[model samples]
Target: MSIPDTASMPMFLRAEDFSFSDEFSDLVEFSFLPGRDDMVPWVEYSGGLPPKSLWGDSICGENTITIQSDMYDFLDMGALSFVPSDETLLKILETAEHNRKCPLDDRITLGDDIPEFNTELCEYTLTIARSITETIFTRDPYTGIVQEHSPPYPDIPRFKLTANPWMVSTHAYGAAFCHRIHLPLVQRVGASIESGTLPTVFKPVFKPASFRRNNVPTLTCGTSGSDVA
Candidate 1:
């Protein structure tokens, strides 16, 4: 079945809008539908399924399939850009700070005498923020075409420490990253259909996959309002 016109266009594009190599194209197919023992040709040809770090497990059902992936993974794969929002960065920072002070007895701790602010963590945060905000990506949601805006993000502060962690509950990095992976899959599936290679038994139906993020409340116990002493 043909994809609907509205959803036909891909939602991701390469940096400078360049084309992906034939090898990469082949990799994408194998990457798709991972862990399907029934279809092992692609995996067998490619020296086994890719590591979980690069690709996520495939979620399959009677009618639909969902693939999960990390933003950095795609970026490593030559994705033009993958920057988590300022909010996500802040939350990550907050969680890191909170967890540093409140380490679980079971899990390993960085050290007993943690500094007021972790120098390495702070430096890492700044580096990631710079990488993301350095290039403002104004992406077309439907076409996946990315237009680079100079001067980066002007309004949103690169990073901010929220006094009240409770005020922040929502996380968007997963959803954003989900789209990053979704667009490519859509593009490839569409190509398969056009090439008359898509399985005849399967019907083409695309649905908006749901992405979930864990809040600090779930990860740590006790009051997140103040540091544990």
Candidate 2:
């Protein structure tokens, strides 16, 4: 699962957008279908590497939630460079402006206000946008790969991109942060995957003894508009 261009791109939506490192040391869990456990693609993706992931658990509403993330913020450079038809260029510019600069300062408190993220969210958007451009123009993975099933995506790469644990962590952390902020972070993620990056699997950390499972789940397109608000 190579990294996609969406890993670094700018994105904004009405209510839109959107790792791990602890498991390698002592704690361990083995399963036949680790995909059900939801922690494989990321594990394998980060093997023999430093922590590109982040994790935490908190009470959201009533259920205790456990979060382990290995995803990324891909950019959509093509979209940026894309010169829309004259009929809709103005709308594109307007939408870009709105997303790039969200005016609502009314902060929502997640478990607590994450100070670092407060300043970094805007900055990350810019970086994520760049990821899209760079991944698309520079990598060119999807250009050569064959999508046997006639997949919806056109330019996604054939395999994993370089390790950027922060890529996955950024989105995951953002969602968690959204939880604190009382924003629809989860919804934002869905929008992003549709509009920004690819679907991520819960990758396995360790090479399997018998077989390889395409587990780590990437983001997916659901019944939601693609964008992060």
Candidate 3:
């Protein structure tokens, strides 16, 4: 059976009003997964792995590291600390002294003086600071004017929704129908039948000469009948 083009058809039926069986609901959910290929589960790995330190212990081969779960609980209110190494601590002190002498809004400007700070850590810290500044200040860089950060409106695709809600919801039901329903039905029917050929009821009508044109070329006799052209 042929299905009508849902895109060309008007949406007389709203999805909310439609009733579906539990089995159909399960199938719809299964179909939805394939459509959303981009979606990944939040928890990728089942096992928990302990964090490793940047510098490996050269002398004792064993360095005991303990992490209190509460300290790094970002999801909830918790206190975090920066326990720097002896080397990093010295660099931090130097940077603090420099800041006290000549304070700068941008941490990146202090990079020349603080050579001990790792490139990766410096970039990461600067990036975070810049992002925070942009959010808090919300200023026009060219004009040097501070603007209020306006609340962002919901970015819904109005045109696509208005054009075809059904197509958008089902990711075009034709693909889902063929994969989930029609192909499976054909396979089942094929398996049941003893004969290799499909049943007459399932066969489509064939017209061998359907494409032949009615117009045909005819030979015209010359004015002089004696000469056969």
Candidate 4:
């Protein structure tokens, strides 16, 4: 049977806009691996989410609304590290680093300094020194700055999350493996340039888009596994 058009239905919903309901929260917990006891459990809390001021200013700019929701509110932020799949990817990044023109005072390049533990699962140790506040989005305008590198990570399209959160959480493991890069390097160098810091760090920057919605007012959510920055 064909579904009828309902006036009350939401015309559209952006992937960034989502609910933090009890049922979805439970699903988020279930999606985690068995031994992640260190990860905090989702609690049933009332009232609204942490203030907009708490997340700081919008990435889009001032006056525009910026909203973000994570699976674990109390997640410990630290350096995210992973080994390159092969020498080709590393070579591409190294070439990009050399080609980019920047003032010497503001520039920091990894060059040929591939970590000794580059092949293993190691934490990007440098991130430990940075404050948690530094990692999140902020008020600074993006200077249209970009570096040329091979497609190091897969496209984490927004529309993908509209499907079952379980699928996204599961695929996040795969994405983590695929998305691995030396983010600590980005963190250190960005700290020098005002516009470089936050944008270098991976974030779900919202954009204007349109799509149909379902009946239930459900929210999009996922596990920390997807955060393979």
Candidate 5:
């Protein structure tokens, strides 16, 4: 089944706002149905999933994902050491400062000796800095094909901070990043598809017959509708 064009879809919706029509319910269910073990071979092969980080076991307590002090210090220095050609990082910092809940404003008056500044605030700041750096430095997969494609680093000037400083600071940074950077990249992908300019590397094709799951017999392609025979 073909996916609907998202350009016409609403930007946001609440769960209480809408329900699937009865006629389309079955189609939706079928579309999302979990893949059967027998049908695995019919799918195209992509690269293997990334290995889990070795540091996964280290994080603990309420701040499970918080960055370690030494790492946070390194990221902090990295963020401040180099200025981007644009004001993106400055704007990010400005947005964080204006946020009443953000630790920035508080940290400014409290001097450099505060414990939270060394810990929680430091972690949040490092996260934001690393995210922005990744956006600016990463190369596009289809860089040559999409000449117009560029990173729309989120306009931090227009960003608004929420009341809960820690949560709001992190969330706002992420939302802005996605809205500015990731969304445009996705739109570029769709444009590539529509224009039939997608690179050959991206085109999906069937995997070899030798591809097996748990030593099971592979099903024949384009026949018997996912049966094992």
Candidate 6:
């Protein structure tokens, strides 16, 4: 399936590959561990999956397709403090801070007087602090914004949900995480730049080749020891 300018994107849990219905599905469950009670028990499933469609590294269900990680990064408990995957994010920040764009770059610097935090996201108004994170993305005062390299805490990707949503709540997790990094950093960039402010919104553009839709579609996939209610 050739991708258009935009994807009518939906979220997923244990996603394998993309599908028609997954694009339109309203929500996805993400959990860090098994036996978590956060999923909606499905009485009926509906995604126009082509014959033999599958999701993720494996299948998701009998009739559903797993969303491609290429298009989306599925987050679960692993992505929490455990996964610690933020190098890519920091590199992206360095690029934006130095170049005023999101291309890759090596010219990173840490500001001599950066603010400090000693509390959890729950301790503070995260939505406001998140604006600071967005600033890290756009105006990164810290030149060497390497993850876990110089920290009391690592620069990992995570969320401060009222609930512990993980792989199952992939939609909620992804959207919230996206919102966390996307909005705050962009907002900070607008306020930090010496020149005119840039757009305080992050718009990720998927590569062109990924839109190819000539492949097969219907998928049978799900995590082992897990069942859709």
Best by TM-score: 1
Ranking by lDDT: 1, 6, 2, 4, 5, 3
State every prediction's TM-score relative to the real structure.
0.23, 0.17, 0.17, 0.18, 0.15, 0.19
Whole-model Cα lDDT of every candidate shown, in order: 0.26, 0.23, 0.21, 0.23, 0.23, 0.25
User: What would the per-residue lDDT of candidate 2 be over residues 86-127, giving only the tens digit for each residue?
Assistant: 222222223323332342232121112333212123122211
Q: Supply candidate 3's per-residue lDDT for 173.
A: 23
**Model 6 worst lDDT window (10 residues):** 39-48
- Stretches of candidate 1 off by over 4 Å are 1-24, 28-81, 105-229
Clashes within 3 Å, all models in order: 1, 66, 0, 1, 1, 46
Report the lDDT tens digits of candidate 3 across residue range 17-70.
111111112111111112112110100000000111101110110111112222
Weakest ten-residue segment in model 2 by summed lDDT = 57-66
lDDT of 4 by residue, 32-123 (tens): 21211111011000001111210222111111111234423322122211112223233323433432344333433222234421212222
Q: In candidate 6, how many Å is residue 105 off? A: 14
- 10 residues in a row with least lDDT, candidate 4: 39-48
TM-score of 1: 0.23
Model with the higher lDDT, candidate 2 or 5: 2
Give the per-residue lDDT of model 5 (tens digit) for 1-229: 8654546742221111111121111111001001221111111111011111101111112112222122333222333111121232233333323332333223232112333322222221112333333322211121211112123434211111111122222223333344343333223222221232222432334446664333112212122111010
lDDT top scorer: 1
Q: CA RMSD for every model?
A: 20.3, 19.4, 37.1, 20.5, 23.0, 20.6
After superposition, the stretches of candidate 6 with alpha carbons farther than 4 Å from their true spots are 1-84, 101-174, 177-196, 199-229
Query: The CA-based lDDT of model 4 is what?
Result: 0.23
